[model samples]
Target: MPAPPIDARSQNARVLGVELCGDDGALLRIMPLEPVGLLRAGRFFMLRRVDGTGPYIPRPFSVYRQYDDGSIEFLIKVMGPGTRSLAQSSTGTELVCVGPLGNGFPELEAGTPKVMVAGGIGSAPFYLLIQQALAGRHGASLAPEDLTLIYGGRKAGFLYDLEAFMDLGVRVLAATDDGSAGFHGNVLDCLHKQWEVGNLPQTVHLLTCGPEPMMEAVAHEAAAKNLECWVSLETYMGCGVGICNGCSLATRPDGPLGAWPVAKACVDGPVFSTSAIEF
Candidate 1:
């Protein structure tokens, strides 16, 4: 999904040294990815390669950070043309990024627990959110509340670190589409089993992101429990800002007129509350 390339005029709006509250990127020059904030697990950022001439298409990626030094990272699965280019980038190839955009999960009440459900790359955003929540950002604290993050991937290799999330005082539950990881079922099934066994604690907010199917499934569970849930959406967005209408989606039937759920993936959001979104 190519967004219109940045025009000559667009170049004038460029800012220097984005002043990252958290700066982290890898591949020195090739594939540099970092978090923009004390990223909330359900938070996201607009991503676009800085070196470009065409409509600079922007996409949303989840945050991957677990530290307190304001460093954010992402789990990038190289499966596309854009990313392939970034993966092949040389050292110090700084990318042009826009925003710690979109609405993120708000502070959970002190007594409220948190349950994170992630799918593949979707888990990336939550990684930071979980970190921040546990760190007590925005008057949000997990001190008295329990934290559980359910992570899913295609297989064992796609899976990364449950220990890290656990280290943040989060109880991690892992699953794979295949029976290749901790659970022999999907994340939904894992959540179901927890539900069946009454393992999910009350006063827990659920945050989820990843493949559309997994998110839809998670949505079902959140609805079942009348729980507050947040979601990050991935779309082929062009124009990191809303100027171009590249990555857009159809709003739900209950949406406002002309309410294209397709907000600028760059400007509007890479992250949205499950209820506020049409998805």
Candidate 2:
């Protein structure tokens, strides 16, 4: 039998996959869906905001899967009215999406030491990267212990799937603002103490996602230690596809004083190097 002729809009699909982030949080899948299996793994995605009561704004979510399922996925945390409406959406609803957007991390280099810092729900994007890294094939020869995930949550329950990361052969270090598990303090505090004790590992690069302040702290720490770092920014979006300026951000490290044209977080990047961002 012939396949469906293929929807042109499907090539830039939004309804890629839907899954639960937590109990109340819902994560939507996205993809530049095309002839099945064409989408590459690790590419990014941005999609239109579900039309809610008012205050129109497109939300940005990283495409966690682009593995040719003709769909990709995004992880979301239900924060307010907009996301609540989105969380209630039934699967198979027609959606407007964009990309495979923004540049992602350079695959973990062979034998290169690396750290993944996830704040709250920011761990979404690197879930796949962790899987790949654990396999020792991050586009270069690598190893599982060569990477680690240091994630911070408000408490023990907020730390999702601790065993999943551990089973992948990646040591998952954890911290809670409340000291419920692992360490008691900021994830950065844990990182600094590790660095002080010479446990951070050498030749390490950091890949991170989470709240802006958290990512900023991680970036600053990485920069101070002369470690290479890549940060995924989570800014509010009016249009996840870059059409709206709501998601725009100042590009240069120094804004107004030394900053310049702001780049749209949805387009220019949801991921960027520490040097490229003001935060």
Against the true structure, whose lDDT is highest?
A: 2
For every model shown, what is its TM-score relative to the native structure? 0.74, 0.79
Q: Considering summed lDDT, which 10 consecutive residues are worst modelled in model 1?
A: 20-29
List the candidate 1 regions with Cα displacement exceeding 4 Å: 1-41, 48-58, 66-72, 252-266
Model 1 — TM-score against the truth? 0.74
lDDT of each: 0.58, 0.65
Candidate 1 lDDT score relative to the true structure: 0.58
lDDT of 2 by residue, 11-105 (tens): 33445456666445666754443544333223454444444432354455665544545555556677776565555666555444544555556
- Write down the TM-score for model 2: 0.79
- Residue 132, model 1, lDDT: 63
Worst 10 residues of 2 by lDDT: 1-10
Q: Residue by residue across 1-279, what tens digits does model 1's lDDT show?
A: 323223211211121222111112221111224423344454444555677732365455555653344444555655565654444454454566555544555666666677778876566666666666666774566652477788888776666555555676667888877787788888888887876788876546777777888887777777777888766667666654556667565555453324444445444455555665565
